[model samples]
Target: MAKIPGVRPPDLSELTRAQDRMTFLYLERCVIHRESNAITATDERGTIHIPAASLGALLLGPGTNVSHAAMTLLAESGSTAVWVGERGVRYYAHGRSLARSSRLLQAQAELVTNRSSRLRVAREMYAMRFPGEDTSGLTMQQLRGREGARVRRTYREQAALHGVAWDKRRYDPDDFSSGDPINQALSAATTSMYGVVHAVVVALGCSPGLGFVHTGHVRSFVFDVADLYKAEYAIPCAFEIAAAGYADVAAETRRAMRDRFRDGRILERCSRDIHHLLLPADEPEADDLGPDVVRLWDGGSRTVAGGTSWDGEVDW
Candidate 1:
């Protein structure tokens, strides 16, 4: 079950198929089931069919239940199903990977496994956050300090601009009510960012635990990537949502953050950033290093002139 059973490998033609352009979707109050080629959700009201292929990731929030068949279909369609807590504020578990290739993942592992290369990639990530800045010589500690200072400054600036009282970020995962409005909103915003970043990370065939900066957790890479966007998107959105004085700040913040992610094309940006970080600029292209394949497409048949067709089974 480690690999999707009986699913055909994805090809170039499959990539252009019409599907949901929306990268992430949060849904609740439904029971998901597989119906033929589509996944449908049913509730007390009625049934709503979901085009699983269109989605990058499906956020199963509170009150949602999914069948094993639905999960299978989702995996086959190259969509990830993420189970989350209320308002999609917490990540509980993930279903399956939608990645079609191991090329990028292998590259990420090579970079992460080497101490020197890991440090270089970490610095590269920081440099992207603060464009035009020279972070080449900064140690990990110094990078953390600078990043902390930048985040604090951003919080202060956002609070001042939004006229919201920001004491500090305080939150308890077990007790959400313990945190103030701003902190709660910040948590919600960051969680949303993490979910989206996770989707992109998986889609790009990278291990979530193989983070350049953040470490320890299984989703270390997800945290590392999400932090890149917090200052510009999540932090500001949280402050602004708090300032607006909405009764349901968490929900409103998530809704607004979702809109921001869509407008910012965060998924595409994250994919590009991860690639630039993991793949060295001077590294040769994958095709250049791999076996050459002279492919010929005639009508509906695919012919690899000198190679055998890949069977459905993969080593994983």
Candidate 2:
């Protein structure tokens, strides 16, 4: 594997930052491989070089072939590789992290594993969804009721604004065509947002399954993060795209969603929101893991347990 002369290897640190990079790229019907120092994709159309380091997430849709070398390059570069269905409709898999520290993951697990702390985190997330509204002392069930009402209101508002027929969200996994055009648009838009949030979550060393607001699914944390921006981006974009009634509705929605992502700085907002949700007012400093801290692995890791800070050791 000779180094390509002009291709400078990506700096792992740069991959953590969400700014100044393309947020989303959808690639389908291609064969992706590592050529020298670059990732190149070939298809019946032609060949193109993928800027793996500068991309937030690469959506590998149907009819795509990916090599192990390509995955290795993408993982090292900090760009996520998401295996999605057509038009990024479904999320199936994700590449590895570019993170070295597990601090965020530990904090999230601590909060989620505690019943009281989990409820508090859930309340905090719901509070953000409705700024200036008091959500004090509300139970999780109460929060769910309020959230449902709010979302229903949002749907009605969007439908009224765009004059699209307001029906329940209908989608059959086996038959996507069964759903109406607007539902399809909504699905495409939200999944795109989820993809972006998932990439940022993993990059920051957080578990996508350890979520407070959303639970059960593997991507519950992703849904939790994406919901923060749903009203601002997904709902409105779906309405606008559906109202236009373009000949190619899916393509139109995808393009408009990408535009909205850029205009709204969605990826940057997602990064900030995840940090805010997981790190509270009394969050432990990055270097401090207090008493009861369990060191799980030994590496370049520094851990403080039993009144001592040791290097390259696991304290169980």
lDDT string, candidate 1, 1-316, tens digits: 4876664533434442212246677889899997766789899999988777667788899888888888877876667788998878888887665554566887888988899999988998899788889999999999999999999999999999999997788899987767889998999899888888888777666899988898888999998988888899999999999898888888899899989988887776787777777777786433111222455444474544435555543565
Clashing pairs in 1: 19-54, 20-54
Worst 10 residues of 1 by lDDT: 284-293
Deviation from native of the Cα of residue 139 in model 2, angstroms: 1.4
How many clashes does each candidate structure show, in the order listed?
2, 0
Q: lDDT of candidate 2?
A: 0.79
Model 2 spans with C-alpha error above 4 angstroms: 1-9, 13-16, 35-38, 282-316
Root-mean-square deviation of candidate 1: 7.4
Alpha-carbon TM-score of each model against the true structure: 0.83, 0.85
- Supply the TM-score for candidate 2: 0.85
